[model samples]
Target: MGFGAILDININHISTRLAYWLARNFDEKFDKLNVGKHQIKITSDTVYEVFGIPKGPKKVEIIADKRKVKKQEKI
Candidate 1:
């Protein structure tokens, strides 16, 4: 919960039935649920509303490896 936000909410147990259905129903290419004839829209707003996770930009942390990187050689 609140993945990209500073104030994160505690995680609770997920619904096994619903999760299973979603896993099987979700279409990656369409970004929606293609269950039979129904096409359920899955947007950023919907995601935030459903999961409480931030639908905004995320902060990325990169750790540089020192040992593997060599210093520039003089020309």
Candidate 2:
């Protein structure tokens, strides 16, 4: 329905299949797989780890617009 929900669904689907394949075939060759904005790592032969911050969003600062103040006229 929403963008976030759709993105999450796709991520889960792809990651699940990728993890399965990696665990089955290349468990010893590679340690991690970069899928989109996520990093899936193989911790052990049967253990897989997923982190959303490996290449996901970063810290950001929002700046507010400054308004110029008018000078008062001299009396």
Best by lDDT: 1
Estimate candidate 1's alpha-carbon lDDT, on a 0 to 1 scale: 0.69
TM-scores of all candidate predictions against the true structure? 0.48, 0.21
- Which ranges in model 2 have alpha carbons more than 4 Å from their true place? 1-30, 45-75
Predicted candidate 2 versus true structure: per-residue lDDT over 1-75, tens digit per residue: 213333355331234555566566543556766555676665533231233323434655554543432333332
Off by over 4 Å in 1: 1-11, 49-53, 59-75
Model 1: per-residue Cα lDDT over 1-75, one tens digit each: 334552364644345666678899999888999779999889988778766766678864564787654444432
Clashing pairs in 1: none
The TM-score of predicted model 1 comes to 0.48
| Residue 37, model 1, lDDT | 92
Residue 40 CA error for candidate 1 (Å)? 1.4
> Scored by CA lDDT, what does every candidate get?
0.69, 0.45
In candidate 1, how many Å is residue 46 off?
2.5
True-structure Cα RMSD, model 1 = 13.5
